[model samples]
Target: MIESAFPIVEVPDMEAALRFYRDALGATVVYRFPPDGEPLFATLQAGSAQLGLGLAEGATAGEGAGMLLWFYVDDVDATTRALSDAGYLVLEEPSDSEWGERVALVSDPFGTRVRLGQPIAPQPDEE
Candidate 1:
């Protein structure tokens, strides 16, 4: 039984990435390595979602590719609009999906793509 999963995003600049996660995505830094010194690694929380940010070197070198982080919210449209207002890049506008979800895609300042989704209630069967 898995307890929890934390997605780690490696970035070239840790401070800038931290700012984007904290200010743009509303994530709070829960823990940081070297507490008093510069943070090379840190954990953040937004509600129940936990995320890890680290320097892009050594084992973590490379851009966020072939991975799409999904953040589920109450209102996909509202969140998308808010993100747009904040100057984030909207990769895909909010829209209904055939799989019964309202979803939108956006990219962080560092090119990390994230998908925001809200589950749609199932409709009554047609007679």
Candidate 2:
């Protein structure tokens, strides 16, 4: 089951990107990584929609169209499994991410890669 979806845009410079989106489009910073100092990722709210910006290499001329469609699912592994069974190309197996989400990558029918992610559930307490 999918909960929500968003696009993660690749950017070369976080500060410059923030300035562009915030000044030109009036996008406000909603969330950012590394509580202090530099951030590797940031989420901005432009009107009613939220957009994610992540630092990526090879982004030139301040234009980045390398966007990844991210889906928040109920179960990352199960979702990837179903997609794989249905003949979709599973690019990466489901794995835990450092940011507290289980994630997987798969290529859509049109060859565009999409990411599936879900919050990691708390572990059961041992007796």
Candidate 3:
């Protein structure tokens, strides 16, 4: 059984990526390497979700990844609209799914898929 996990994105530009996650997503820098100097690695916290940003050596952000990062939000529609309005690429518009979720997908400048989802209550069963 998995205990806990956090997604890490390797970025070519640390400062820019930091701003994107921080300002756009409202993540706060919880930890950083070399606390006093240039940040090569850092951890960001937005509610319960934590994202790690590390300086990319050879691999770029979201390069050759088979998994998509999902973020659970309180309001999928509002969050999707806000992110899209801020110039992020919207891969999927907010829509209701058969699985009882309202979901939307957007990509960062580096092509990282950020999926926002809000759970919807199930309908009553037929008699």
Candidate 4:
């Protein structure tokens, strides 16, 4: 049986990741490896979702594992804009998708691609 599952990403700077995630997404620091000083690994929780950040040794920003992170936000456009204003690169603008979501693409502080979306409410049928 599986107890829990979450994505743990390697980051060039733990503090940078912490600031971005915490400030932008309102994530809270659930735990840290050392609990003091500079931690090598930290886990954050935002809503029901959890993300882990591991300090990458001898690695520069944007050098970690290449993977696209997806998140379901309350407002895709607003969230994307905040991230972009915070210096994250905007890859795509928010638009409605055929899959019933308003989706947008942006890069995190470490240059990792992040996809944010919110389900679009169904429209009423007109006679």
The per-prediction tally of clashing pairs is: 0, 0, 0, 0
Predicted structure 2: lDDT: 0.70
Off by over 4 Å in 4: 1-4, 59-66, 123-127
What TM-score does each of the candidates earn? 0.79, 0.46, 0.82, 0.84
lDDT of 3 by residue, 42-122 (tens): 999978878899988665545456657777888988888888888888899999887778999888778777788888766
Give the Cα lDDT of each candidate.
0.80, 0.70, 0.81, 0.82
Clashing pairs in model 2, backbone N/Cα/C closer than 3 A: none
Model 4 worst lDDT window (10 residues): 57-66
TM-score of 2: 0.46
Full ranking by TM-score: 4, 3, 1, 2
lDDT of 2 at 75: 80
lDDT score at residue 111, model 2, on the 0-100 scale: 43
The C-alpha local distance difference test score for the whole of candidate 4 amounts to 0.82
Pairs in clash, predicted candidate 3 = none
**Residue 121, candidate 2: how far off, in angstroms?**
2.2
* Candidate 1 residue spans exceeding 4 A from truth: 1-5, 57-64, 122-127
lDDT of 4 at 55: 94
lDDT tens readout by residue for model 4, 1-127: 9998888878888888887777786789999999889999999887788999899965543435568778888999999888888888888999998767899988777777778888888732321
